[model samples]
Target: LLSRLYRPLRVCGVVANDGQSGGGPFWVQAPDGVVVKQIVESAQVRMDSLVYRTIIDLEFLKHVDF
Candidate 1:
């Protein structure tokens, strides 16, 4: 998965199956070797939504000089 993301230089969504019907975790490693993990438990609401949203908001603020 990390290889795929690196090749495309984009975010990828993943779903894991263990035959038990539950959401799994997603992970990404930065170019500087920082690791990030997101544990998702339900399809209704992602556990990483708040983190992703905050990152987006921060980027927006930087772009707008806010």
Candidate 2:
């Protein structure tokens, strides 16, 4: 059921990529101050901004232990 799918986890997760794959995870802030995890593709973020790219790299740490 959707309720089972929506169950909260006791902890957040982080996974490292030694540079092979593309997409990564990030904490995106909502207008109301709620921050949620999002899986972002490399081409989807602003590659021109160093800050944004770096932040995206940080976000890349979470996900992919599977």
Candidate 3:
């Protein structure tokens, strides 16, 4: 018998609140019908939306830990 892995096989860096850090996360549908998580930059996001602005304006007093 084989044991199934409960946790994700890999975890990639997603969008961070800080302007200086990493890229953002987006959904990608695979040809096999599985949705994949991808990390993207600001260029991928629409700067015209209020939602995007809200995310950029969010404050962070300290470094967050996952």
**What is candidate 1's local distance difference test score?**
0.49
Candidate 1 vs candidate 3, lDDT winner: 3
- How accurate locally, in lDDT, is each candidate? 0.49, 0.66, 0.57
lDDT value, residue 33 of candidate 2:
75
Q: Tens-digit lDDT track for model 1 on 9-53?
A: 445465434346554454546587878665445563444789754
- Choose the strongest candidate by TM-score: 2
In the predicted model 3, the residue pairs found to clash are none
* Predicted candidate 2 versus true structure: per-residue lDDT over 2-65, tens digit per residue: 8546987555444576667666666678687767666667787788999887776664355445
Judging by lDDT against the true structure, name the best candidate: 2
Summarize candidate 3's per-residue lDDT along 1-66 as a digit string, tens digits.
Answer: 133266557765543465575565556576877776666566766779998667645554223333
Candidate 1 Cα misplacement greater than 4 A, ranges: 1-17, 28-35, 42-66
Candidate 3 residue 32 Cα shift, in angstroms, is: 12
Candidate 1 TM-score, C-alpha based: 0.23
